[model samples]
Target: MTTFYTVIDWLMVFGYWLLIAGVTLRILMKRRAVPSSMAWLLVIYILPLVGIVAYLSFGELHLGRRRAERAKAMWPSTASRLNKLKESRRIFATEYSPVARPLFQLCDRRQGIDGVKGNQLQLFTTTDETLKALIRDIGLARHNIDMVFYIWQPGGLIDQVAESLMAAARRGVHCRLMLDSAGSLQFFRSSYPSMMRRAGIKVVEALKVNLLRVFLRRMDLRQHRKVVLVDNYIAYTGSMNMVDPRYFKQDAGVGQWIDLMARMEGPVATTIGIVYACDWEIETGKRIFPPPPDVNIMPCEQESGHTIQVIASGPGFPEELIHQALLTAVYSAREQLIMSTPYFVPSDDLLHAICTAALRGVKVSIIVPRGNDSTMVRWASRAFFSELLEAGVNIYQFTGGLLHTKSVLVDGQLSLIGTVNLDMRSLWLNFEITLVIDDDGFGSDLACVQEDYIARSTLLNAKEWQKRPFWHRLLERLFYFFSPFL
Candidate 1:
C-alpha cells in the first residue's frame, strides 16, 4: 500500500509538470515577452505545486480575447478624442497654463490624457470631505451618473451614497455603477447590489470569479479605479474608496482615514466620463459611446498656478502610463521630491530612480504607514528601505493614521495626486489613474501636506533601521524573497 501511494504521488507530480510545460510552450509560441515567460517557467520548474498555484493566481492575463478585441475596436475612438484634445491645447497654446505643458505632453505621449482647458480642480484632504463632495455631486447630477470603484460597501457613508444614487435613478437620471467583482465580493454577497437594483440603479460586476474562470484567467489584475463622473461635466477620481470607515479596520475607528480626492470640470471630466463609459460597456455589453458634444467646458475658479493632466491606466491599455509618468516627473525634479503612499513596494526601476535621484542631490523623501495592513508587504517594504536610506533618501513612517494617499510633490513645481500606489501591483498589475499637475501653488499645497506628515511621523534613520533585531531582519529577507509574487 505504501509503495502504491508513493507511485501515485510521483504520477501526480509528473502530470503537474506536463501541464506546466504545455502551458509554457503555448505562451512562448504566442510570443509573449521572453523574460516573463522564463520567470513563469522557472517558478513551475523549481516549485511545481506552488508555482502552479502562483501561475493560476497571477500568470495568465485576465481579459479574454473577446474583451481584448473590444478594447482594440474602441481604441480608434479613444485616439480620436486624444487627438482632438491635443489640437485644442495647441490652438489655445497661449491660453494654456505654462506649468501644465510638461504634464500635458507627458499624458498625450504616455497615458493619452488630453489636456483640456477651462477645467476646475478641487482637492479634498479627508474621507469625510471626499464622501460629502461625492454625495453632493451624485445628488446634483442632471443627465447621468457613472461610478466605478474597487470597493463599494453598504452601511455608513457608503450606504448614504448608495441611497442617494438610488434616489437619482428613480428621478430618471441614468445611474450606472461598476464594481470589481474580487474587491467588492463581500459587499456584493451582502445586500448591497440587490438593494440598489431594487431602487432602480443599474450595477455591473467586473470580472466575476469562478473556479473555471480562475484557471483560465488571472485573478490578480483588478480594476482599481475610483471614479465618479456626473453629467459628462464634473468628475471625481482619487485614492478614496466608497466604503464605511473608508477601508476595512478591526477597530472601525482606530485612525483617521486620510485620502486625497480631486474634483474636475472641463475636458478632463469628459475624459474621466469616457473611462467610466468604456469600463461600463466592457462589463455590461451596453455601448454608451461618443459623449454628447454639448457637454459643458467651463473654466474653473483657479486656486493653484499649476497645469494639470489626468492619466488613466488599466489592463486594456498597453502603456503603463502612471508608472512612466512618475519616473518622468521624478527624473525631472531639480530640487526636492516628496511622496506619500499607503503601500510602498517599489519596482526595481522606481527604486533605481529614487536612489539615483537622491544620489544626484535631489532631496527625496517617502512617507509610508508605520504599521501596514499586510504583514508580508510591510516586511518586504522594510527590506528595501535600508538601501534607500543608504543612498540618502529620507524615509518617514506616518504615525497618526493609515496614510492612504498617493501623492508626490516635485521641486515645488510639479505635483502628482491620484489612486496609484508606489508598488509593483499598482505600477504593473492593477488599473489606476493619477492627475499630474504643473503648478507652483499645487506643489506648495502638496509640500505643506508632506511637511505636516513629516512633523507627525517618525523618521527612519539608517543607524536605527540597521539596529533592528536579527529575527526581524530575517523575516524581512524571507518576505523580500517572495516579493515578485507580492
Candidate 2:
C-alpha cells in the first residue's frame, strides 16, 4: 500500500507540473509585458494550485460572450460617429504644434474620439472648488444632465451633488446617473439610487457585483471613469469622485485628499456625452434613446475655445491607448516635465522613459503623497525612489494631504487630465477618460495648479533616503516584486 501511494503521489506531482507548463504556454501566447509574464510564471512555479487560482481571478480580461457581443454592437455606432465627424470637421492643421500633432494623430487612430473645436478648459485644484463648480453648473442645467462616476460616497460634497442631481431630476431635467458597483458600494447600498429613481433620475450600476455578474467578465475589471455632461454643452472630467476626500481613509496622517478636475465648454462636451452614452448602453444593453441631442444641436462656436480631443481607454481597446499616448508624449518631451499621481507603480517602459528624460537634461519632477492609504503601494513607490534620485529626478512627497491628482504636463505646452492613474490596473483594467490639450494658455493654467502642489511637498534627498532603517528599505524592495500587477 505504501508503494502504491508513493507512485500515486509522484503521478500527481507530474500532472501539476504539466498543468503549470500549459498555463505558462497560454500566458506567453498573449504576449504581455515581460515582467508581468515572468511574475505569473514565478507565482505558478512556487505554488501551482494556489497560483492558478490567483491567476484565474486576476489574469484574464475576457468579458464573456454576451458582453463581448454588446461591446461589439457598440463599435458600429462608434465608427459611424467617427466617420460622420471626419466628413464634417473643419480642418486646421496649423492649430497644433508640429511636436504635438503626431501624438494627437496616434490617439485619434486608436481612440473613438477626435479633436473638436470651440472648447474652453478650466482647471480646478481644490476639492471644494470643483464640487462648487459642479453644483453651480448642475443648477444651471436646463435640458438634461448626465453623470457617471466610480465612487459616490454619501457625505458632505457627495451629498450636495446628489441633492443637486435630485433637484434637477425633479425640475424635469433628463438626469441620468451611472455608478460603478465596486467603487460606489457605499452609495449603491444606500437609498441614493432609490431616491434618484423616485425623483425620475435614470440610474445604472456598471459591473454589478454578484455571482451572476462574475460570469459576465473577469471580476477585477471596473469602470473607473468620472464624467459629467450638462445639456450637451458643458462637461467635467477628472480624478475627483462625488465624495469627500477626507473619507478616503481613517487615522492616516494625511488629513484629506487633494484632486483636480477640468471643466470644458466646447464641442468636446459632445464627445464626453458620446463616451458616457457608450458606458450607459453597455451596462444596460440598451441604446441611448433619443440618440443624445445631435452634436451640432448648438450653434457652432467658431471661437468659444480651442481644439482638444477626449481619449477613452479600457480592456476593450485593441491596445492600451492611454499608456501609448503617455509614452509617446513623454518621448516627445524636450524641456521640462511635471506629473502628479497618487499611485506610483508604473510600467517598465514608462518608468525608464522618465528616468532617461531626467538624465537627458529635462527637469522631471513627480509629486505623490507622503503617506498613502495602501501600505504596499507606499513601500513599492519608495523602492523606486532610489533609482529616480540617482537619475537626478526630483521626487516630492506632498505633506499637506493625499495628492490624488493624475496629470502629465510636457514642456508646459500640453496638459492631460482625467481618471487615469500611474498604475497597471488603470493601464490595463479600468475604463478611463482623459482630455489631451495642446493649448499653451490652458497648459500654463495647469502648471500653476501644479506649482501650488509643489509648494506643499517635501523633497527627498539621497542622503535622507539612505538613512532609513534597513528593514524598511528591504521591505520596500520586497514589495516592489508585485508592482507589475499593483
Candidate 3:
C-alpha cells in the first residue's frame, strides 16, 4: 500500500508539470504582446492551477467559432451594402484639414470607410437633454428604431424612453434593442426586456455570459457600443449608457455621471445605422436593414455640414484599429491634445505615445473624475500620473461629477467622440464605436465642452501628486503592475 501511494504521488506531480507545460507552449504560440504573454506566464506558473483557470476564463479573445464564422460570412454582404449606402448618399472624398487628414487616411485605408459629408451634429452634455432628445426622436419614429447600449438600468427617465419605444411599436414601427448581457445583467434579471418584447419590440442581448462555456470565450467581453438610429435618418452615439444618473450608482458615492452624446443627421446616420444593422444581424442571425433607396434623401451640402467617419473596433476587427487611430491622433497633434475619459488605464504603447506627444511640446491635457467608482481602476489610473506630469502633461480631476465622457480633441480641428474609454478593457476587449469629426465648428464646440470640464476640475501638480500617502502609491503600483492583463 505504501508503494502504491508513492507511485500515485509521483504521477500527480508529473500531471501537474505536464499541464503547465502545455499551457506555456500554447501561450508562446499565441504571439500576444510580450508583456501580456509574460504576465500570463507568471500567473500560470505561480498560482498552481488557479492561474491556468483564470487564463482559460479571461486571457483569450474567445469569439465563439460560430460567431467568428458568421461574422466572416456576413462581411461581404455587409461591406457591399455599406458601399452602396455611402455611394447612394453621394459620400465623396473629404478634403480634411491638414492636421486631421492623416488620421482620416489611416482609418479610410484600414476601415474601408471614408468621411461622409452633410452630417449635422448636436452635442448634448447633460442627462436630461440627451434623454429628452432621444425620447422625442423615438416618439417621432416613422419606420424603424434601433438602439444599443452597454447598460440599461431601469427606472428614472429610462422608463420614459422605454415607454416611447413601446408607443413606437404600437404605431406599427419596427423596434430593435440590443444590450450587453454582462453590462445589463440587472436589466436582464429584471422584467424590462420581457415588457419590451411583449410590446412587439425585438430585444437581443450581445455576448451573453455562460459559466458553463467559460473556457470557450472571455465572459467579460462586452458590447460597449451605445448607438440609437431612428428611421435610418438620425443617429445618436456616445459615452452615455441607457441609465439615468439620478438612479444609477447612487450608492457608489461618485455623484451624478456627466456624459456626452452627439445627435447626428444626414448621410452619416445611414452609415451608423449600417453599423447597427451588422451588429444586429450578428446577434440575431437575421439581416434586418432595408435596402438603400434609389434616390438620396439629403444631398451633400458640403459648405455647411460636418464630415464624419465611423471607426468601429473589437475582437472581430483586424490589428486593433481603434488603438491605432488613437495613436495616430496623438502623433498627429501639432498644437494641443485634450482627452477626457472616466477610465484612463492605457496600454504601454498609448501611454508612451501620449507622453511623447507632450515631450515634443504639444500641449497635452487629460481630465478624469476626482472620485472613481472602481477602486482598482482608480489606483491603476493614478499609477501613471507621475510619468504624465513629468512629461508636462496637464492632469485635471473633475470635481463636479463622475465625468463619464470619452473624447479627444486634436489641434482644435479634429475630434473623436464615442463610447470608448482610454483603458485596456475598452481599447482591447469591448466592442466600441468612435466618430471622427473633421470639422472646425464641431471641434470648437467639443473643445468648449471640454473647457467647461476643465473649469470644474482641479489641475494636479507633479510635486503635490508625489505627496500622496505611501500606501496609496503602493496600491497604485500594485494595480498598475496588473493593468496590462486587466
Best by TM-score: 3
At residue 50, give the lDDT of candidate 1. Answer: 82
In model 3, how large is the Cα lDDT of residue 373? 94
Model 1 per-residue lDDT tens digits across residues 1-486? 999999999999899778978866765775544545666777788887788777766776667656667777776777776566555442122333443455567666665544544556788887778888888988898888888889876667877788889989989998888889888888889987887898778888887776676666677778899998888878888888887663467463437656778887656676676677677666666677646434234433432223456677776775667777788877877789999998887877788999999999999999998877678888989889989998999999998887888999888877888889887778877778887776676677778878888898999988878889999999998777666556
CA lDDT of every candidate = 0.76, 0.82, 0.88
User: What's the candidate order when arranged by decreasing TM-score?
Assistant: 3, 2, 1
Off by over 4 Å in 1: 1-42, 83-103, 111-113, 251-256, 290-296, 299-306
**Residue-level error in angstroms, candidate 2, position 371:** 0.9
| Per-residue C-alpha lDDT of model 3 across residues 314-395, encoded as one tens digit per residue | 7666458899999999999988999999999998899999999999999999999999998889999999999999999999
Q: After superposition, how far is residue 475 of candidate 1 from its true place, in Å?
A: 1.2
Model 2 residue 64 CA deviation in Å: 3.3
Better of 1 and 2 by TM-score: 2
The most accurate candidate by lDDT is 3
Q: Which residue pairs clash within candidate 1?
A: 306-438, 306-439, 307-438
